[model samples]
Target: MTKRSAGTTASPRPGRRRLVIGAAVLAAVLLLFWQRDRLSPRRAPSEDDLLAASPAQSAGSAPGRDQAGPKPRWVGSKNAGTGEDAEASARQIAEKRLERARHTLEGYVQATRYPPGARPLSEKPDLQKPHSVAKNTLPLARPDHKLTDARVTLEQDRLYLVGDEAARLVASCTTSDGPARCEVLRAEARVPETMPQASTMPPARVAFADEGAGGSTIAALFAPAKEGFGGYHGPIAINLDLRIEGEEGAAQFNVVYTPAPPARLTGDVREVIENGSLCLYLRLAVDKPGRYVVVGRVDDAEGDGFAYLEHNDPLGAGAQEAKMCIFGKLVLDERAKSPFVLRDVEAYLLKEDTYPDRELVPGRDGPFHTTKAYPESVFSDAEWQSEERDRHIKEFTKDVKEAEGELEALP
Candidate 1:
C-alpha cells in the first residue's frame, strides 16, 4: 500500500463492491415481496385443497365412512340460489289452485238456495166464474160394434153419459145369442145423422153449486190450441173449465200446471198408467183438514167426444199441513176412429177449505190419484239440500287461508 494523503482514499476491489450492491438490491426485492404477500389478497385454494380440508371428505377416508357412502357433492352458492328459486315457484302454484277451489264453493251456495224456475203462487184467485159458452149435444156411437150401446148428452153445461155402450165396447162381446147377433146389435146402435155432431158444436159454459159456509172454490179455464191433440178436425176455439171445492179455512194451496209432460216423476203418483187417457196430478196442502172435491169436463180436440170427473175425498192432517195428491184421468172415446185427441189441459184451485172433519171414502188408485210426478218447490223435499251446501263452502275457505300464510313465510 502506498502512503495515502489525508484527502485521498485507497482503491477497493471491483468484484466485492459489485457483489455488495447486488446483494442490497436483492434484499430490497425480497422485503418488497414479503410486504406484498402480507397486505395483498391471498390466492384462493384450488378445489382439491378445499375438498381435502372439508370434514365430510375427511370422514370418507376415516373408518366406517365407506358404509355411509361418499359425502354428497358440496352444493355451490349458484346451485343453492337455484334451489331457492324452485321452492318459490312451487309455493306460487299451490296458492293459485286453492284460490280457484274457494270460488267454486261460493257459486254452488247461491244456486242451491235460489233455484232457477217459476216460484210458488203467493195470492189466491178471485172466486168468480169464468166466461164460457154452453151447448147440448147427443153422444156418438163408438166405431167398433162389440162395445155396449152408449149415449152422451149435455144438460145446463153438464155432460152426462146415459148408456154403458162404451163399457161393452171395451169388454169382449159375451152373448149366447151369437157373434152375428152382437154385430147386428152394435150396428143398430150407430150414431144417427140427425144427432148433433160434437165436432160442429160450440163450447159450453158451466157452473157449480157453492158448498156450505167457509168453503172455497177455484175454476181454471183453458183455451184449446191445435197442437198436441191428434186428428182434431173442428175449430180450435174450445174452452174447458176445471172446478175445485175445499172445506172451511183451507188457506194454503199450490198448483203446478205443465202443458207438456214432465221429463221426470217420482213418488206415489208415478205408479199410474197414462195410456190413451188424458191425465192430471195435483199436490194439495191444507191448513184445515177435511174433504175436497175437484170437478172438471174434458173434451176431444176433433169434437169426437168428451168426459167428466168428480173427485170427492177426505184429506187428513197431522203436526204439519195435510198433504194429498189427486189425479184425474179422462178416457177418450174411440181414440183411433177419430183424429181428435185431448190437449192443453190446465188445473185451477177454485176453492180452498178450512179444517173440516168429514167421513168420506179415500180416493181410489187409478186415474184419480196423483198421476204425474214432479219436484216440489223451495220448502219441498225435492229441492236441493241447504245444510250440505253450506258445509262445502266453509271447508274450502279454510284451506285457502292456510295456503296464503304458508306462502308469506316461505321467503
Candidate 2:
C-alpha cells in the first residue's frame, strides 16, 4: 500500500463532538417548548366546546341554550320613516310606547281605589267620573296629537275628562229620589292631560245589590268643587252613576269618602268585602277631607264577584307579586256625631246580628266566626293555623247608639 499522509488518519474527535452538540441542541429545544406551554394563559372552554365534550351535560341545561346568547337580528335604524325612511322607525317607536302606556293606565284604573260619593268636583261632566264615563279615557292625547297625556278636571266636586276635544257632554235627564227630586245625566267627553283637585265630602251610604249576574251598580255624591270647609262654597258638585248586573241579584254599590289615605281607603275596602256581604252603611263626615279613595268588593261562594269605587289608578291591575295593603277600617266612626242613620229597619237588622257562615268567606271554610279578614293566601300553613280564634273576635263588637240626637238632626 502507498504511504498515507499523517493528517489523513481517522479522527473520531471532531465527529464525536459534532454528534454530542446536535443531541444537546435537540434536548434544549424540547425544554423551551414545554416551558412556553406552561406559562401561556389557560383559556376557559367555550359553550360549543362544553357541549361537544358531554352530551349529557348539555341536555341537562336549561332549554334553548343556543338561543340564550345574543342574536344578530335586524333593528330599525334611527330616523327611519315610512316607505323605507327613518321617520317610519321613529313613528313605530312612538306607537309602541303609546300602546304600553295605555295598557299601564288600564291596569291602574282596574286597581285604582275610589272613595264613595267624593266628587271629581269642578271637572268636566262630559269626562270620566268615578261612577260614570267612557271606559277608555285616562291618558289624554297630547296637544300635538302625536303623544298622549292624562288629564283630570276637578269642577263641581267631580273628576272630569279633558284629553281629546271630541269628548263632550252629550245628554242629561231628571229623576226622583223619594220626595227629593234628583237628576240623572249621561255626559260624554275626552280625557284631559292632568288631574285636578279632588272633592272632600264622601257618600254617606253605599249598597251593593240588585244586579243579577254579570252586572253592577254604583252611585255616589261629593262636596261641591268650589266649596270651602263644608259643601257650601266648594266647586261644582260631583257624582258617580255606576251600574253592573248579574242574574239572581245585581251588585249595586258606590264609594264613600273618609279622611284616610286614598290607597288605604280603596285597597282596604275591597279586602274587607272579601269576608262578608259588606252591608254596613256609614254616614260619617270627615274631619279634614282633601282627597280620599273608596274601594268595594262583592263576592259569593262561586268566586264570581264585582268591585267598584276605587281611587287607585289602573284599578285592580297590578303586578303578579303579592303586596301588603293598608288596614284603615275604623269601625269606630269618628264623625263626632252618630255616623249612621239607624232607622227602625236598620235597627231591626242590627238586632239580628248572627255570625255569618264560613262558606260566605272565600278562603275560610268550616264553622269559624266571621270577623277580621286573613292575610293573603301565600302565608305558610303553620302561620295560618297560629291565628284562628282571634281572627273574628276583634271585629265583633256591640253597636251602641250614643250619638242618636246628632243623627236625628240630619236633613
Candidate 3:
C-alpha cells in the first residue's frame, strides 16, 4: 500500500514474506562468519541425529520437520495453559524451540550446494553470510499499508539494460473488498531530473479479470522499446498512473532502475557434471565485464520444478563463460527428470553494493530456453561433498549438541 515518493524506487520494503523458517530460533547461536567456530563441550551429533536431520526435498517444508519430532508450540496461543500446566507448557515450548534451533542449524549445514539464485526458501536461514549472492528483484508480495480497498505490487527485476530491446514491468493489483476493478491510465519512460520523455506507448485500457469471490486482479505489462530509454545508461525513472475502483483520480507512482551496459548471451551452451554438480556453461559476448551474476530455473521433462541455477563470477572482457551449477544430491534427492528445460534465464552486471545494484544484460528475457532435454541418466546421483560442507558440519554439530544438552538439563 506504500506509494512511490519522488526520486525513490517504487518497490516493496524488505522482509515481505516470513523470514527463513526457524531463522529466529537459530539466529542467536548460528555463526555469521566462516572464521568463527563455536565449539561446545557437549560433543557432536550421533549418526542417528544426522539421519534424522536429513535434507528435505520440498523447499517449502519447515527445517526440522524432515524427521518426526515434537511440533513446536508457537508463542502466543490463546489460553496456552493454566497455572501448573502453564509452567509445563512453557518448558515444553522452550524445549521445542531448542529442537528447532538444532534442526535449523543442521538444515543449513546439510543443504546441497546451490547457486544463490537457486536458493530454496529456507536456504541462508541465518541471513548473515557476507559471501552470499543476493538477487536484485522487486518484492514478491505486497507491502502492508493503510490502503484498505485496493493494493498494488510490482513483479520485475530491479534493473534493465538499455539494449534489452524493451524493459517490461508487470503490475499486479488486488482489492480487499468484493469484485475490484483496476486500470492503467498512463505509463511513460524517461531519464530522470528533466522533462518526461515522450510516452513510449499510448495509454491503454487494463482489464482486471474478476475471479469470482477470490478477488479481481490485473497485470499491466509495460514493455517499452530501446528508444524509450533515451540513450541513457544511468537511472531510468518511470511515471505510472493507474485507476483503481474506489480510488480518486490517478494514483501516481514513480520507479527507478539502472540501465545496464550492454552484453549478449551468444546462444552457445554446454552441460557437464563437475565435482558432483551439474553445470551449464553459457557463452557471452561482452565489451565490458566486471562482476556478473546469471540466474535461471530448470524444470524436468514433466515440467516439474527441478533446480535453480546461478553463476556469480568476475569475467574478463570478450568471449567469456558463465558456469551455473546444481548440486548432484539435489537432483537425485528430488528424483528430477532428464531433459531439463531451462527458463527464466537472466544475467546482470553486479555493480556497487547499494540500491539498484545491477544492470541487466540485453536480449535475455522471457521464457528463455537454455538447452534441450538430455538423458537424465547422465547426471550423478551422489550428494555433493566439499571441505566447506565438512567444516559446516563440524561447527553446526556443536550447535545441535548444545541445544540437546539444554533440553536434557531442563525438568
Q: Which lDDT tens digits does candidate 2 get at residues 38-89?
A: 6653322342242233212221122222333442222442222354454443
lDDT of 3 by residue, 1-411 (tens): 867788986544457424553576467556543224333212223323533553333432223332554533324333334556655755564565566667656566455444344554234343222112333322112233333455555444433444444334445555555344545555555555543433433333333233333333443343333335434445554554555564523332233433445467987887786766667788998767799987776766687656766788898899999988766666766777666766667777887876457666754434455455445565666644556655655655765676677667656
lDDT string for model 1 (175-223, tens) is 2232111111111111123334434433333222322222221222222
| Candidate 1 CA-lDDT value | 0.30
Error of 3 at 348 (Å): 0.6
Q: Is candidate 2 or candidate 3 better by TM-score?
A: 3
**Deviation in Å, model 1, residue 246 alpha carbon:** 61
* Candidate with the greatest TM-score versus the true structure: 3
- lDDT-sorted candidate list, best first: 3, 1, 2
* Candidate 1 Cα misplacement greater than 4 A, ranges: 1-81, 115-385
RMSD from true fold, candidate 3: 21.7
**Model 2 Cα shift for residue 360 (angstroms):** 22
